[model samples]
Structures are given as C-alpha cells and as structure tokens.
Target: MPSGRPSGRVPTAEEGKKPGARSIPPGLAPRPRAVPDYVVKYPAIRSPRQREGYKGVFQDQLAEYTELLGEVRTAQRRLRETEAAMGRLPRHATSRTRVSRGRDSAFLEKQQRCEYLKKKLTHIKARIQEYDRDARDSAVYF
Candidate 1:
C-alpha cells in the first residue's frame, strides 16, 4: 500500500527563486557622450557666450589666412614673369626701375598680408590653449 503524497516532487533551483530576483529596477539613464578634448580646450570654454565668440574669431582668422595665401601666390607668379622678361632682354639692357618698383610694391604688400595672417593665427592658438585649460579643470569636477 502506497502513501497518498506524491513520490517525486522536488523543486528546481530556478523554481525556488524569490520574486525580488525578477523585479529589480533598471539602472539610471545612460550618460551623454563626452565632448571632444580639443573643443573643450578652446578658450571659449570659459563661458558659453565666450565660446561662440571665439568660434567666430577663429573662422575669421582662417578666412584671412586663406586670402593672404592667395595673394602671396599671385605675387610670386608676377615676380616670376617679370624675371623671365628681364632674362630675354639684350645683354646691356635690364628691366626698368618702374617695373622693378611695381614688383617690389606687390611683393611688400603680399609679405605684409602674410605677416598679418601669422599674427592672427598665433593669437587664436593662444586663446585655444586658454580655453583648453579651463575645460580640463571643469572636467575634473564632472
């Protein structure tokens, strides 16, 4: 004669788990992507408005540099043409002073423009360094 109770009813490990195992809440929202280091390093990081201003300044400087480069190239081509013409002249004859003066003026103007561009580039680089330092300091707190 067998007992009325079931003979083989063992609870599996999974079946004996607590309700809390399935009810745990998810973690906090995902963190935002980090800003690039170079951008943060820009001097504009001092303030939002300053950052915008620096961007504008940097763009302007870049445009000026491009223009200066073009002007320098044009001047160089003209100088080369003038030199070629002088070479073709008679042995005793040379390019006139007026022609030389014009070339000199063009060269000087191009040189000045290049110098100005260099100065502006240097200033922008300094500002960028300042901005980067500020950004790094702020990031430490974050």
Candidate 2:
C-alpha cells in the first residue's frame, strides 16, 4: 500500500529561501542607463557612397574594359583564321576563281573589323586614363 500527498510547497523567508527572485548581487544587477540629451537629440551621420575614397576610374570601368578587350581578342582570332584560310587556297585559284575571290573578300573584311576593334580598345583605354586623371586632380566626395 502507498499514501498520496502534495509534494510541492512555497518556500518561506524564514528559511532564507526565495523561489522566484533573481540571484544577482545588488551592486552588479542590471539597471537602465540614462543617455545624455545631446546624444539623443542629434541624428546619426551617414555618407551617400560607402566607398568614398578615390580608387581610380579603372576600377569603376573594369567591366567595360574587360568586355572590350575580349571583343578585340575575338576579332583578332577571327582575322587570323580568315588569313589562314586564304593561305591554304590553291595557287592556281586566281582572282577569277570564285573560291579565291570569296576567301580574299573574307580576309579583307576580317582585317578591317580587327582594325576597328583595336581602335575601339584604344579609345576605351584613353577614357580610363582621363577618368583616372580627373579622380587624382579632384575630390569626388564632399
């Protein structure tokens, strides 16, 4: 046989026991800190551009430069392939020969395109240099 009884009871102050009170010491206990009026009155200051320093124009236009350089390389490769094909044509294939004429035209067109790509690349490099010079001479952020 067994007896049933309530196992829980409220602790009393006489026993130097508090069931729910925080155990932190009085001096070290957390308290609300009152901030100064000036600190609370002013709004936070922030810059528009996170990266304000003058990291040259080259960095800013890096993607464009890379894309143009890739175009130039592709044009050069195409020009080389066209030249090689023209060279492989038989010596007997003269100006009157359709195959010879076609190869010659292709070679000329590819050469012109390669030249244009080279000029465009030079223009892009000049623009980047100008930007760099401007960045060096002037303060971008106020």
Candidate 3:
C-alpha cells in the first residue's frame, strides 16, 4: 500500500516549488498600467479651434464676473444707506413715542434688498464655477 492517500493527479513542477521560489503568488500579479484612451489615440495639438473657442468663452465669463462684482458693490452701498438711516433713529426715554411706519418699512425693504443681493452673488459664484469647469474641460486634449 502507498504511504500517502492516492489522489487523481500529481502536482506540477512549478506548483511543487517552495513559496519563496515563486516569482508571484497564485492570486497576485503586477497590474498593467492603464493609459487614457484619448491620450493614446490623439495628438496634443489636435483641437486648436476648440481651444480658441474655450478662450473666447473664458473671456466672456470674465466680463460676467466683472458685472456681478459691480452689482455687489451697488448692493453694499444700499445696505450702508439702510444702516445709516437706522442709526439716525432717536434713542429717547419717552415710552409713549412710537417709531414712524415709513422708517420701519424702509428698514425692511433694505433688509430684503440685502438678502436678494446675497442670493444673486451666490448664483453668480455658481456660474463662475461652471465657466471654470467648462474652460478646464475644453483645455484638456489627447
């Protein structure tokens, strides 16, 4: 009788080697580095026309940013005016003295304007980010 239990097959020479003798483990191998498909297929200068278009779009975005900055400045001025008007109200000891409706309305209006301006600024900032993304994407080439 055989000393070892009989199996259907015997191990191959490579599999019979010591663990350290194997160049790579059964489950592990160096992965092949991947190259971007676009870079592999196309030259860097393939789209000059598209690059020009992106530059034009970027310039337009710069102009829009300037306009938004101006609007922000105007909003700041309006806010300052409202604050100054609020400051002018008398701080008197008379309990019976009522604040004027006109002043209160003005103050509310100014607050609303400031809020609107802040929202507008946020919108403009989002637009700027979109423009930047577009510019970046357009600049990328194979």
Candidate 4:
C-alpha cells in the first residue's frame, strides 16, 4: 500500500475474488476506433470489382482526382484542429480601431482558410465520384 491504492497485492483464486465490481475486465482490451468515412472514400482505387482501370475520359481529370485524394484527408484533420482552436478564440472584438488580441486577425484568416478547404473538399469529392461513375460506365472490359 503506497497510500491511496485499494490493494497492494493481487487476489489469488484460493483467496477468492473481491466483492466490488471492476470498471474494466482483467483480460479485455479496448475496442479499436472506427476508420473515418473520409479515409475510406478518399482512396485512389475506383472499385475492387472493376479492376480493368480508368479510361480516356477520366484520364484528363487525374489532376483533380489526385488533388482531391491528398487534400481531403489533410483538410479533414486541419478542420478538426481548427474547430478546437476556434472555441478558444474570442468572438467579438473589444474595440473598433483594434482587435483585442494583436494576432487575432491572422488567426482568423488561418481559420477561414481551413474552413474553406473543408468546404471545397466536399465539392471536389462529389465531382470526382461523378467522374468515376462516368468513367466506369464507359469502361471497356476485356
């Protein structure tokens, strides 16, 4: 007993189990967190079943596709961090001539850019998916 600890030694089978319920079971591990939808949806693959590959129509759109794939995940992560930071930021300025915080304007601009990326990502993802669908429809399977 170091002081506040309930027990210094483990109870053996011969000693019998403790009466009070434990918060977590002895052998159980915590469940793994689920993968976010953005990660799953942002993969480069068109589909597992349609393995033939992309066509000419979608070839020219590869720039947009790659950009979406890279940006969506990064934007998603930045958006989460920005959201927490946004809560700590002061909403109303104390005076008309100057901001209460000297660097508040810069922080606000960074926050707006993060939000813009997040919004742009949704539209990009939708456009990419639509292009993917069109490419798949016209794909020639061997």
Per-residue lDDT of candidate 2, residues 1-142 (tens digit): 1357664766565456565665676699888997643234322222323122222333544555566556656766875776677778776764334444334565556555555545444454554455656667777667
Stretches of candidate 1 above 4 Å error?
Answer: 1-45, 96-98, 101-107
What value does the lDDT take at residue 96 in candidate 2? Answer: 31
Better candidate by TM-score, 1 or 4: 1
lDDT of each: 0.70, 0.52, 0.55, 0.54
Q: What's the residue-level lDDT of 27 in candidate 1? A: 81
Question: What residue runs in model 3 are displaced by over 4 Å at the alpha carbon?
Answer: 1-46, 91-142
Q: Which lDDT tens digits does candidate 1 get at residues 1-142?
A: 1778776878886678887685344585566897644444443345757767777877887887888888888778887887778779885685466466345776787788778667666666777677778777678552
Once superposed on the true structure, which residue ranges of model 2 sit more than 4 Å away at CA? 1-53, 92-142
Write model 4 residue lDDT over 1-142, tens digit each, in one string. 6688787687776457566745566678698897645455444545544322333324534545455546555655776676566657676623333523333565555555555445445544565676678777989999
Per-candidate TM vs. native? 0.53, 0.30, 0.31, 0.28
Residue-pair clashes per candidate, as listed? Answer: 4, 0, 0, 0
- Residue pairs with colliding backbones in model 2 are none
Q: Which ten residues in a row have the lowest lDDT in candidate 2?
A: 42-51
- Candidate 2 lands at a TM-score of 0.30
- Residue pairs of candidate 1 with colliding backbone atoms: 41-131, 41-132, 42-131, 43-131
lDDT tens per residue, model 3, 1-142? 2868777688898779888785676668878887643333322323447445545554655666566656656766776775566667665633223534234565556555555445444444454556667668878577
The TM-score leader among the candidates is: 1
lDDT for 2 in candidate 3 is: 81
